[model samples]
Target: MSRAKSPFSPAAVLRGALVPMLVVALWQGLSMSGLINPVVLPSPVAVVERWWAYLLPPDPYDPAQGSWFLWALSGEMLFDAWSSLYRVVLGFAVGAGLALPLGLAMGGKPRIYALMDPLLQILRPIPPIAYIPLAILWFGLGNAPAVFLIAIGAFFPVLMNTIAGVRHVDGIYLRAARNLGVGRTTMFIRVILPAATPYILAGARIGIGTAFIVVIVSEMIAVNSGLGFRILEAREFMWSDKIIAGMFTIGLLGLAIDIGMNRLNNHLLRWHRGLEN
Candidate 1:
């Protein structure tokens, strides 16, 4: 008869914040003690100040700036955030869209799986970073190359998990559906898909994170208008504060995306939870 604690409860929030706060305190103490070089590792307070400025900088409006793309790259935090988010979303969509169907086919049919698995295994071991050079060469220096890298990073996890999910659908459910006179298509749509949804969602969470990592790395080389690009630009100028701030921004964005995905999973998997309970 014990009650479940809400994740958003004050105690839960405090518990989550505790470790980060402690780390920040230790960082500040080290900075004050002159144990860490400010140029190399700016204090938490300095990072925060820089982040505040980056979040709310003076308008760099100039009619001569001409293109909207150039205006966005003019040290605007929101634009950088939006740019990164856009790439992640587009890339993830492309990756998951292709992966889900192919995975379904591969999982459901041994012949297809046998045909495709070897090539995939070979490709999967190679890191997505390895594709960056070719992606840039093919797509040139815009969102396309970054999106391509992110998609590659996202694709394998989702494909593998989806295949596993479909393959591992409960035998009981399959037998029940067959006994109930369900057609192949009907059985797959109604029984297999519902049962496999949880695993597919798990893959999606992992895939989204992979997309974020790839997009950032790709932006550092492929593009010039994301948080990743900003971080690199800051490094070139030796603006350690801005670098730290950009890093924090990326972390926060990733965290927000993770939380959103978790919420989606919870909402979608309510039936699975009930079955387990």
Candidate 2:
């Protein structure tokens, strides 16, 4: 007799893939049936064709020397995508690095919380977009300002979560550690940090997602060489296909980053297994 396949089999993968295929098929079918305007909602095939033309530009079809064509370097959407990605990573890292330590300090001591809570309340309410004018005045336009915005965007979620996590660490665990004559440093490193790992991962996940939004907005305002800028440029030229492509690229990148972070989260919090399941 044939053995039954495992739950994690390739068959499960095929089942997951079917939903998107069906959705794409429906979209393409609607366009082909004239239910959707080719101008307003171009078929997937048209988008793919335009994407092809945009990427692999060819010799002039018309003899005009200065005919409008995609820019050889800046026009490649992938370059812009990479540029935005680099800034997001840098900014998100800065936010997390600073937030975690500050959060720990506040959570570990009442005095620190009294000093920092009011500032967090005032700043957290201010949306990243609202700060664009000030950020521009402070840092000027370019990657520096864009990264600053992303850092600002990512900082709060991590900071707030980390503080809560550290504070809520099991009191019993701390008592147990103290009974064992653990030093303050050993108590924090050995008892508190591990207990707060789940919350830290949760905060990191949220921060990464928030960073994606901030990075895009920052790029639109401050940077001239990222996916957001490409989207703006495509709109100016009325290249809807490229515009959609850039938006899709940003979304795909965000989803991929989130998935990777979740995997990391799961690995770090394995002891808390089935909590999220």
**Best lDDT among the predictions, by candidate number:** 1
lDDT of 1: 0.90
Model 1, total clashes: 0
Residue 264 CA displacement from its true place in model 2, Å = 1.4
Give the per-residue lDDT of model 2 (tens digit) for 1-277. 3454655689977887899889889989999999867767777877777766655535444435454543344346657777888988999999998999999999999999999999889999888778889989999988888888888888888998899899999899989999999999998888898998888778888888888888888877887888888888878877777777777777778888978887888778878856553
How far residue 195's Cα lies from its native spot in candidate 1, in Å, is 1.5
TM-score of each: 0.87, 0.84
The root-mean-square deviation over C-alpha atoms between each candidate and the true structure, in angstroms, is 4.0, 5.9
Candidate 1, residue 13: how far the Cα is off, in Å: 5.5
Error of 1 at 137 (Å): 1.4
TM-score (C-alpha) between model 2 and the true structure:
0.84
